[model samples]
Target: MPFSFPTGAARFVAATACALALTSLVGCSNGEGGGGDSTTESATSPSKSGGTQVTINDFKFQPASLTVSPGAKVTVVNNDTTTHTLTASKGGSFDTGDIDPGKSATFTAPSKPGDFPYTCTIHPLMKGTLTVE
Candidate 1:
Protein backbone atom coordinates (compact mmCIF):
# COMPACT_ATOMS: atom_id res chain seq x y z
CA MET A 1 0.00 0.00 0.00
CA PRO A 2 1.14 3.56 -0.64
CA PHE A 3 1.72 5.99 2.20
CA SER A 4 -1.01 8.58 2.58
CA PHE A 5 -1.69 11.69 4.66
CA PRO A 6 -4.36 11.14 7.33
CA THR A 7 -5.92 14.63 7.18
CA GLY A 8 -6.71 17.33 4.62
CA ALA A 9 -4.24 19.75 6.25
CA ALA A 10 -1.56 17.09 6.13
CA ARG A 11 -2.25 16.49 2.41
CA PHE A 12 -2.02 20.22 1.70
CA VAL A 13 1.29 20.40 3.53
CA ALA A 14 2.62 17.45 1.60
CA ALA A 15 1.54 18.95 -1.71
CA THR A 16 3.19 22.27 -0.83
CA ALA A 17 6.43 20.54 0.00
CA CYS A 18 6.40 18.76 -3.32
CA ALA A 19 5.65 21.97 -5.14
CA LEU A 20 8.51 23.80 -3.43
CA ALA A 21 10.92 21.03 -4.29
CA LEU A 22 9.89 21.11 -7.93
CA THR A 23 10.18 24.87 -8.03
CA SER A 24 13.74 24.70 -6.71
CA LEU A 25 14.67 22.11 -9.29
CA VAL A 26 13.25 24.24 -12.11
CA GLY A 27 15.06 27.34 -10.86
CA CYS A 28 18.32 25.41 -10.69
CA SER A 29 18.11 24.13 -14.26
CA ASN A 30 17.41 27.59 -15.59
CA GLY A 31 19.90 30.45 -15.04
CA GLU A 32 17.53 31.89 -12.41
CA GLY A 33 19.62 30.44 -9.59
CA GLY A 34 22.47 32.91 -10.20
CA GLY A 35 25.06 30.12 -10.33
CA GLY A 36 25.95 30.10 -14.03
CA ASP A 37 26.90 32.75 -16.59
CA SER A 38 25.75 36.20 -15.44
CA THR A 39 25.07 37.37 -18.97
CA THR A 40 22.78 36.39 -21.88
CA GLU A 41 23.38 36.61 -25.61
CA SER A 42 20.86 36.92 -28.44
CA ALA A 43 23.06 36.67 -31.48
CA THR A 44 21.79 37.83 -34.87
CA SER A 45 18.31 36.45 -34.51
CA PRO A 46 15.22 38.26 -33.35
CA SER A 47 11.52 38.08 -34.08
CA LYS A 48 10.36 40.10 -37.10
CA SER A 49 8.05 42.31 -35.09
CA GLY A 50 9.08 42.26 -31.42
CA GLY A 51 12.73 42.47 -32.45
CA THR A 52 15.65 41.92 -30.07
CA GLN A 53 14.94 42.68 -26.44
CA VAL A 54 17.22 43.27 -23.47
CA THR A 55 15.45 42.82 -20.18
CA ILE A 56 16.47 45.05 -17.31
CA ASN A 57 15.71 43.32 -14.05
CA ASP A 58 17.35 43.35 -10.59
CA PHE A 59 19.66 46.12 -11.82
CA LYS A 60 21.19 44.03 -14.60
CA PHE A 61 20.54 43.23 -18.22
CA GLN A 62 19.09 39.75 -18.71
CA PRO A 63 21.14 39.33 -21.90
CA ALA A 64 24.29 41.29 -21.23
CA SER A 65 25.48 40.88 -24.80
CA LEU A 66 23.41 40.86 -27.98
CA THR A 67 24.05 40.71 -31.74
CA VAL A 68 21.58 42.15 -34.22
CA SER A 69 21.47 43.39 -37.75
CA PRO A 70 22.41 46.94 -38.57
CA GLY A 71 19.53 49.38 -38.07
CA ALA A 72 17.52 46.68 -36.35
CA LYS A 73 15.20 47.75 -33.58
CA VAL A 74 16.41 46.80 -30.11
CA THR A 75 13.87 46.92 -27.30
CA VAL A 76 14.96 47.76 -23.78
CA VAL A 77 12.56 46.45 -21.20
CA ASN A 78 12.74 47.90 -17.70
CA ASN A 79 11.48 45.20 -15.41
CA ASP A 80 13.38 46.56 -12.46
CA THR A 81 11.65 48.46 -9.72
CA THR A 82 13.38 51.69 -10.72
CA THR A 83 13.74 53.48 -14.02
CA HIS A 84 16.74 52.81 -16.25
CA THR A 85 18.20 53.85 -19.57
CA LEU A 86 20.20 51.78 -22.03
CA THR A 87 22.80 54.22 -23.26
CA ALA A 88 25.97 53.69 -25.24
CA SER A 89 29.02 54.06 -23.03
CA LYS A 90 31.28 55.68 -25.58
CA GLY A 91 30.12 57.32 -28.80
CA GLY A 92 26.51 58.45 -29.08
CA SER A 93 25.67 55.51 -31.27
CA PHE A 94 22.47 54.40 -29.57
CA ASP A 95 20.39 55.52 -26.64
CA THR A 96 16.99 54.36 -25.43
CA GLY A 97 16.28 57.55 -23.53
CA ASP A 98 14.76 56.67 -20.14
CA ILE A 99 12.66 53.61 -19.57
CA ASP A 100 10.39 53.94 -16.59
CA PRO A 101 9.69 51.00 -14.36
CA GLY A 102 7.33 48.53 -15.96
CA LYS A 103 7.90 50.39 -19.22
CA SER A 104 10.09 49.86 -22.30
CA ALA A 105 12.02 51.81 -24.90
CA THR A 106 13.55 51.07 -28.27
CA PHE A 107 16.69 52.08 -30.13
CA THR A 108 18.09 51.43 -33.57
CA ALA A 109 21.33 49.52 -33.84
CA PRO A 110 24.18 51.39 -35.43
CA SER A 111 24.54 50.96 -39.18
CA LYS A 112 28.20 50.03 -38.85
CA PRO A 113 28.71 46.50 -37.63
CA GLY A 114 30.83 46.30 -34.51
CA ASP A 115 30.73 45.79 -30.77
CA PHE A 116 28.92 48.58 -28.99
CA PRO A 117 29.16 48.62 -25.21
CA TYR A 118 26.32 50.16 -23.22
CA THR A 119 25.23 50.92 -19.66
CA CYS A 120 22.32 52.31 -17.70
CA THR A 121 22.68 56.08 -17.71
CA ILE A 122 21.08 56.30 -14.26
CA HIS A 123 23.00 53.29 -12.98
CA PRO A 124 26.39 53.37 -14.67
CA LEU A 125 27.47 50.18 -12.95
CA MET A 126 24.95 48.21 -15.01
CA LYS A 127 26.70 47.43 -18.30
CA GLY A 128 26.21 45.32 -21.40
CA THR A 129 27.47 44.88 -24.94
CA LEU A 130 25.68 45.09 -28.26
CA THR A 131 27.14 43.64 -31.46
CA VAL A 132 25.83 44.73 -34.84
CA GLU A 133 26.41 42.18 -37.52
Candidate 2:
Protein backbone atom coordinates (compact mmCIF):
# COMPACT_ATOMS: atom_id res chain seq x y z
CA MET A 1 0.00 0.00 0.00
CA PRO A 2 1.17 3.52 -0.81
CA PHE A 3 1.25 6.21 1.89
CA SER A 4 -1.27 8.93 1.33
CA PHE A 5 0.00 12.50 1.23
CA PRO A 6 -1.78 14.91 3.55
CA THR A 7 -1.58 18.71 3.26
CA GLY A 8 -0.13 19.16 6.77
CA ALA A 9 2.04 16.05 6.63
CA ALA A 10 4.45 17.59 4.15
CA ARG A 11 5.02 20.57 6.37
CA PHE A 12 5.59 18.29 9.34
CA VAL A 13 8.13 16.24 7.47
CA ALA A 14 10.00 19.36 6.38
CA ALA A 15 10.02 20.69 9.93
CA THR A 16 11.35 17.43 11.26
CA ALA A 17 14.16 17.36 8.76
CA CYS A 18 15.13 20.93 9.59
CA ALA A 19 15.17 20.21 13.31
CA LEU A 20 17.41 17.19 12.81
CA ALA A 21 19.84 19.19 10.73
CA LEU A 22 20.04 21.94 13.32
CA THR A 23 20.56 19.48 16.16
CA SER A 24 23.33 17.68 14.31
CA LEU A 25 25.18 20.93 13.65
CA VAL A 26 24.74 22.16 17.19
CA GLY A 27 26.27 19.11 18.85
CA CYS A 28 28.73 17.89 16.25
CA SER A 29 31.70 16.49 18.14
CA ASN A 30 35.32 17.50 17.57
CA GLY A 31 36.95 16.31 20.74
CA GLU A 32 37.06 18.42 23.91
CA GLY A 33 37.11 21.63 21.93
CA GLY A 34 34.74 22.27 19.06
CA GLY A 35 36.53 25.35 17.67
CA GLY A 36 39.76 23.39 17.20
CA ASP A 37 42.58 25.77 18.19
CA SER A 38 40.73 28.98 17.33
CA THR A 39 41.47 30.60 20.68
CA THR A 40 37.77 30.68 21.54
CA GLU A 41 35.60 29.44 24.41
CA SER A 42 34.43 25.84 24.39
CA ALA A 43 32.41 23.20 26.29
CA THR A 44 33.04 19.46 26.74
CA SER A 45 31.38 16.49 28.40
CA PRO A 46 33.10 15.25 31.52
CA SER A 47 34.06 11.59 31.78
CA LYS A 48 30.70 10.33 33.18
CA SER A 49 32.23 11.21 36.55
CA GLY A 50 32.41 14.87 35.46
CA GLY A 51 35.16 17.50 35.18
CA THR A 52 36.83 18.24 31.84
CA GLN A 53 39.96 20.36 31.49
CA VAL A 54 40.00 23.58 29.50
CA THR A 55 43.38 25.18 29.06
CA ILE A 56 43.68 28.95 29.14
CA ASN A 57 46.77 30.32 27.40
CA ASP A 58 48.02 33.42 25.60
CA PHE A 59 45.10 35.27 27.12
CA LYS A 60 42.75 32.97 25.20
CA PHE A 61 40.98 29.67 25.55
CA GLN A 62 42.77 26.71 23.96
CA PRO A 63 39.77 25.03 22.29
CA ALA A 64 37.60 28.13 21.94
CA SER A 65 34.36 26.11 21.54
CA LEU A 66 32.91 22.90 22.91
CA THR A 67 29.81 20.73 23.26
CA VAL A 68 28.90 18.86 26.38
CA SER A 69 25.96 16.99 27.80
CA PRO A 70 23.76 19.03 30.09
CA GLY A 71 24.52 18.87 33.80
CA ALA A 72 28.10 17.79 33.21
CA LYS A 73 30.74 19.47 35.36
CA VAL A 74 33.77 21.12 33.78
CA THR A 75 37.04 22.56 35.04
CA VAL A 76 38.92 25.40 33.43
CA VAL A 77 42.65 25.52 34.10
CA ASN A 78 44.43 28.81 33.73
CA ASN A 79 47.71 27.95 32.04
CA ASP A 80 48.58 31.43 30.93
CA THR A 81 50.33 34.42 32.48
CA THR A 82 47.13 36.40 33.11
CA THR A 83 43.91 36.08 35.04
CA HIS A 84 40.72 34.88 33.36
CA THR A 85 37.08 34.12 34.03
CA LEU A 86 34.18 32.21 32.46
CA THR A 87 31.01 34.22 32.80
CA ALA A 88 27.83 32.51 31.60
CA SER A 89 25.94 34.33 28.91
CA LYS A 90 22.14 34.00 29.07
CA GLY A 91 21.32 30.36 29.90
CA GLY A 92 22.77 30.43 33.42
CA SER A 93 24.76 27.21 32.94
CA PHE A 94 28.01 27.95 34.80
CA ASP A 95 30.46 30.75 35.52
CA THR A 96 34.01 31.12 36.82
CA GLY A 97 35.05 34.34 38.42
CA ASP A 98 38.59 35.71 38.29
CA ILE A 99 40.79 32.64 37.84
CA ASP A 100 44.44 33.52 38.40
CA PRO A 101 47.35 32.33 36.33
CA GLY A 102 48.36 28.71 36.97
CA LYS A 103 45.05 28.13 38.72
CA SER A 104 41.86 26.31 37.78
CA ALA A 105 38.12 26.90 38.19
CA THR A 106 35.19 24.53 38.06
CA PHE A 107 31.47 24.84 37.25
CA THR A 108 28.51 22.57 36.58
CA ALA A 109 27.11 22.55 33.10
CA PRO A 110 23.51 23.69 32.81
CA SER A 111 20.78 21.08 32.78
CA LYS A 112 19.25 22.65 29.73
CA PRO A 113 21.35 22.70 26.56
CA GLY A 114 21.98 25.96 24.74
CA ASP A 115 24.62 28.18 23.23
CA PHE A 116 26.56 30.15 25.82
CA PRO A 117 29.03 32.87 24.96
CA TYR A 118 31.24 34.10 27.78
CA THR A 119 34.16 36.42 28.44
CA CYS A 120 36.62 37.29 31.13
CA THR A 121 35.41 40.09 33.39
CA ILE A 122 38.97 41.40 33.65
CA HIS A 123 39.40 41.42 29.88
CA PRO A 124 36.37 42.09 27.65
CA LEU A 125 38.07 41.14 24.38
CA MET A 126 38.90 37.68 25.70
CA LYS A 127 35.84 35.63 24.75
CA GLY A 128 34.75 32.01 24.40
CA THR A 129 31.59 29.97 23.85
CA LEU A 130 29.91 26.74 24.82
CA THR A 131 27.29 24.69 23.00
CA VAL A 132 25.36 22.51 25.39
CA GLU A 133 24.14 19.28 23.84
Expressed as tens digits, the lDDT of each residue in 2-75 for candidate 1 is 97656788878988889867644543121335366554655544544669888887777868888888898988
Off by over 4 Å in 2: 1-50
Per TM-score, the best of the predicted structures is 1
Error of 1 at 39 (Å): 6.1
Which ranges in model 1 have alpha carbons more than 4 Å from their true place? 1-48
Per-residue accuracy of model 2 over 75-97 as CA lDDT, tens digit each: 88888655778787665557888
**lDDT of candidates 1 onward, in order:** 0.78, 0.68
For residue 93, what is the lDDT in candidate 2? 56
Evaluated at residue 102, the lDDT of candidate 1 is: 98
At residue 44, give the lDDT of candidate 2: 63
